[model samples]
Target: MSLHFDHNRPIYIQLMEHFYRKICRNELKAGDKLPSVRETAVEAGVNPNTVSRTYMEMEREAVVVSKRGQGTFVTEDQSVIQQLKETTAEQQMDVFLTTMKQIGFSEKEILDLIQKRLSALENGGDSNA
Candidate 1:
């Protein structure tokens, strides 16, 4: 999957988040081999150092493991996956809440809006519009 880099944000953070989402979606399965830093940088139109930084940051977070000669791979630990699931959920909700707050929606209004949208979705409605 392509990394959707937001120019307004830090590239490394954005890259890391992209990988987190991919991992959480099971797109990058446990033990999946990630592209080389140079290759990923080329594909993502970024500097190799930025990609390397992203990988290193992930390694620090225990989201990926890098072998000396072999390349970086997604963590095979089940606990990591479960933790990532919760982490991704919180990140998604934080973004939603921030957007709602910025739009001047009170907490109650946002909750009500979410409930309404969820009900529509459950009833097979086109709530995207």
Candidate 2:
């Protein structure tokens, strides 16, 4: 997965979230080996220590498991994965609403924007066409 870090938060936290989302989305499945810390760090342009820390945190959360000589793999629990996805979606939606409110967008305006964006996306984003 390609990870982009911003100034708002630490890179390790973003890495953890990114990996969780990937697993929750089934992009990474049970027994699927993850990239090495060095590889991921190089790919994400971050320090290996950050990636290692993120993976360690994920392991502690039971989102991933590591084998002694093998690599880290995504967990196999369907319920846990589903719950994570649901929670992530809800959290993202809440954040979106909060940001909209902060930007002076009313509920109706936000709903309209969502509809428009969905429609545009469904129409291949060719609004003028």
Number of the top TM-score candidate = 1
Flag regions of model 2 displaced more than 4 Å: 1-3, 104-113, 125-129
lDDT of 1 by residue, 1-129 (tens): 466777899999999988898999899999999999999998888999999999999999999999999999999998998899998899889999999899899999999998988999989888575
> For residues 21-96, what per-residue lDDT tens digits would candidate 2 score against the true structure?
7887788987789999899988988989999999899888887888888888887877777878898999999999
* Candidate 1: stretches off by over 4 Å: 1-4, 101-109, 127-129
Model 2 lDDT at residue 56: 96
Model 1 vs. true fold: TM: 0.84
Q: All candidates' lDDT scores?
A: 0.92, 0.86
Error of 1 at 15 (Å): 0.6
TM-score of each prediction: 0.84, 0.77
